[model samples]
Target: MQCVRPLWGLTAAAVCILLLLLLHCHMLREGQLSAGACEVVTLDRDSQPRRTIARQTARCACRRGQIAGTTRAQPACVDVRIVRSRQWCDMSPCLDHEGCDLLQNSSGWTCTQPGGRVKTTTVS
Candidate 1:
């Protein structure tokens, strides 16, 4: 029938589109293609490991149901530096002071510039 010919054409087109979608999903799962996943990683330098930093999780998909390639986000990051707060206080007062033409007062130091006003800094 003439009507059957058009129906067959539409069915073939639908089948072809469905097959393409299935193949795409297969490729993604096999890692031949790329997909998005959240993970935490550390930073390293010259084969040496450093301190642990914040854990960042990134997603590639938007609300519209789309997938992004893995190469776009490989989590290439750097290490974090951890330092003690007390170590900073151990340094001398003169080392921390700057831009002072003179030093005065036993409890605090004065910062002054030529022909400028004087500022006092108390040691904490």
Candidate 2:
């Protein structure tokens, strides 16, 4: 009985930690949304683009009506209306032979050629 109680307590602690992490992320997201500038979260290929509070990278920032995006594997500020249109892949962003995969966040996408070459395009 004593061993079971300790195990249950450990499980509850783990759940609490997870919930705290989620809450922190949510707060961070809410705060960043109101910021006028864009922030670069990660430069890695295997991750999603997340907004941060810092203003260190000027290139990632967008204009008032625009949002952080990427063009041809480079950071760009795309118009908000265009982003919502959901027609990015139709614009042939990738090479003629490569396939374009739009990311869920609409922040950027990845282009993959038949030879397994992958290019990750990311926004702030």
Candidate 3:
């Protein structure tokens, strides 16, 4: 019937869209996609404004198992493994007045006390 034909077309279109979404998700899961979720933040006050407000700042609002990191020199969501592979101590692995040294292997970090002694070794 003519009505049946229209209904079937709508269903087919929906299926196609769903397939595309699934494929995109698969690519993201495989770390083949560079895309990430971004969010906006707003601040308001009833009192007088302070000095001034800058244009805006951007940061990655990543999903679970993901952290804000740089990819291709651009802000992006990266896996925790990728972050740990580097020696930068962005995670604040060490407490105040302590020094953090990344292990040779990317498995963990070590903290040094103020007296330059090994305080603790955190194995990831």
Top-TM-score structure, candidate number:
2
Highest-lDDT candidate: 2
lDDT of 2: 0.64
Predicted candidate 2 versus true structure: per-residue lDDT over 1-124, tens digit per residue: 9899999999999999999999998997775444344455555333346523222233354667876554444445677766677656644567678889878877767789899877755544
Cα lDDT for residue 92, candidate 3: 63
Better of 1 and 3 by TM-score: 3
TM-score preference between candidates 1 and 2, better one: 2
Query: In model 2, which regions exceed 4 Å deviation?
Result: 1-59, 90-97, 102-109, 118-124
* Candidate 2 residue pairs in clash (backbone atoms < 3 Å): none
lDDT of candidate 3 over 1-124, digit per residue (tens): 8999999999999999999999989987655434465433344434434433223233565778877653322345767765856743555656677776777775555667788766333333
TM per candidate: 0.30, 0.37, 0.36
Q: How good is model 3 by TM-score?
A: 0.36
Between which residue pairs do clashes occur in model 1?
Answer: none
- Candidate 1 lowest-lDDT run of ten: 76-85
* Cα displacement (Å) at residue 77, model 1: 9.2
